[model samples]
Target: MAATKVLVVDDSLTMRALISGALERIPNVEVVGLADGAEEARALVERLRPDVMTLDVEMPGISGLQYLAELMEVRPMPVIMFSTRTAAGAQDTVEALRLGAIECFPKPKVAVPAELEKIIAKLGRCIKAAKGATLRKAASPASHAILPQIEWNGRVLAIGGDAASTKTIFDLLGSFPANCPPTIVVQHLNEDVAAAMVGKLDMKVAARVVMAEDGMAIEQGSIYYAPPGEAHLVVDGSVPPRLRLLSRDPVAGARPSISVLFASLARSVGADTVGLRLNEGDDGTSGLDAMATSDGYCIKPNPAGGFELSKKTMTQAIIEPELARMVLKLCSR
Candidate 1:
C-alpha cells in the first residue's frame, strides 16, 4: 500500500520524536516533515503537502488557529488538532472543530512513547474520514408534493438533527402547506441551543415549534421536539398524537433520536408516518440504511444538498414519512 503521508507540527523536539515514532506503527504512513512552529509548518505543507496534519493548538510565533485559517484559505487538507483536555484547552479544541478541523484529540503532557503509537494509528483513521467528510449543502425549497386533493387528514412527520442539521431540516419541511400535516421533531441538542436554533427556523406555514413535554397532546397548529438532555419525547396515538417521556439509551447515538422518534412514528402511525434524517456524522451504514428501510416513507437528504430520495421506493418525491402521510391522507378520505 502507498504510504499515507503526514506532517507532524509541534514546538518540542521530544514531541516531534514521539509523534514521529508513533506514525511509524501505522503500516504505510510516511512522516514527510517534522515542523517546529507555524512558519516552518507552512513551508513544509507547501512543499511536502502531506495527506494530513497533526497540529499543536499552542505553538510559538503564529498561533495555531491563525495558521489554520491561513492554511485552509491556501490549501485545504484534513487537519486534526492535538490538544490537552483542560477547560481552556477544551474550549480551543471545540473552536477548532467549529472552524473546520475534522476531529480533535487530547495531547499527552509528555508524549509517552507507548501511547503515542496508538494515537498515531487512530489519527490515521480519523484523517481518512475527514478527507471523505464531504459537507453537503442544504436542499432547495421543496415542491408542493402534498396533493391539494387531500389535505392534512391524520399523519405525523418527525424531524431531527444536531448543530449542522438545522438548515437542511427547515428547507425540507418548508414545503408543507399552511395546514401542513401534524409534525414532530426530536432534535438531539441542549435546551438553550435548541431554543436558539428554533428561533432561526421560521417555518413558512402555520407550524408552531416547541420543546416537547409529556402528555402534551399533539395539536394541529404546532410541532414538537425533544428538549435537550431531558426525557425522550414520543408520540402516543391519542388524538393528533400525544407526547410522552421515557428514560432510555440514546438510540442511534441520540437520546431523543430521529430514529427512535421516527421508529415510534413508524409504529404508531404505520403508513401515516414521515421522517427526515440530517446527520453530519457518518457513524455506520445502519442509521443510513434505517432511514431508508422503516415501514413508512423514509426521506434521506440527498448528496446534492438540494434533493432528497427514497431508497426503499422509487421516485425521490414519494420518500418515507411524507409518502406515509400521502397514503394516510388518502385513507382518511
Candidate 2:
C-alpha cells in the first residue's frame, strides 16, 4: 500500500515541526511538505500533491478559512484543521468542518510530551481516515418550508457518526420538526467542538439540542449530544427517562462508544429504538449489530436516501420523518 502523503500547513515553525514530526512517526504516513501560510500551502499542494493536508485554523495572509473555501472550490481533498481549544477557535473549527474539512484537532494547552504523543496518534488516525473520505465543495443549507410533524410514540432515535458524517448529521436533524422524537447523538469530536456543535445545531434545528448532562431528562423534540472525553452517555431505565453520564474506561477505543450507546438503548428502549449509523466503520458495527439483536431498528446512510449532501438538490430536498418511520415499519416486518 502506498503511504498516505500529508502536507503540514501552519504559520508557526514550532507548530509545523510538531505536526510534521508527529505525522512522520505514524506508519505508512509520509510528511510530504510543510507550508507557512495559505499561499505556500497552495503552492505545495500543486507541487507535492499530497493525499491529505493538516491545516492550522488561523494563519497569516489568506486566512485558513479563506484558503479552505478556495481549496475546496478548486482542489477538493481531505483536510484536518489544527485548532486551539478556545471559544473563538472552536467557532472557526466548526466553520472549517462546514467548509469540507474532514476533522479538527484542538492543540494541547500545556503541550506536554505525553499529551503531544496522544494528539499525534489521533492526528495520524484522522489523516488515514481522511484518505477514504469523500471530499466535495461545501453546500449551503437547504430550505424547507414545512418541517414534518410526527407523533411521539415513546421511541428514541440514536444516531452515531464519524468524522465524515458531520454534514449528514446536520441534514438529518434538519429533517425533524419542532415536535420530533427524542434523540441522542454520539458523534466523534473533541469536547470543545462538541459543545460548539450542540450550540450550532440548536439554532439550526427546530428541536432543542444540548450537551448531555448527568440526570438530564429525556424529552421529545430534544437532542442530547454525548460529551467527549472519559464519560459515556447512558439512558437510565426510569420512567420519563433521564440521561446518565458514566465515568467508565473507553470502549472500542472510544470514550462515548457508539456500541455502548446502542447497547444501552437496546436494553432501555428495546424495539422502540431507531439506530442510525452514519459513515461509521468497524468501531461502531458491533454496536449496531447488537441493537439488531434486541430487535431495534437500525439504519445505514444510503446514498439514494439523500445522506450524501454534495448535490445541491439533495441539500435542498425535504427530509421526511415518514421515510424513517417507513424504515422502522420494514424492520418490524
Best by TM-score: 2
lDDT of 1 at 282: 37
lDDT of candidate 1 vs native? 0.62
| Candidate 2 per-residue lDDT over residues 53-106, each given as its tens digit | 988888878888899889998999999888887899988877788778888887
- What TM value does model 1 have? 0.58
What stretches of model 1 exceed 4 Å from their correct place? 117-121, 131-265, 268-284, 287-308, 311-333
Model 2 lDDT-worst window of ten: 309-318
How close is each model in CA RMSD to the real structure? 7.7, 5.5
- Model 2 C-alpha lDDT versus the unseen true structure: 0.77
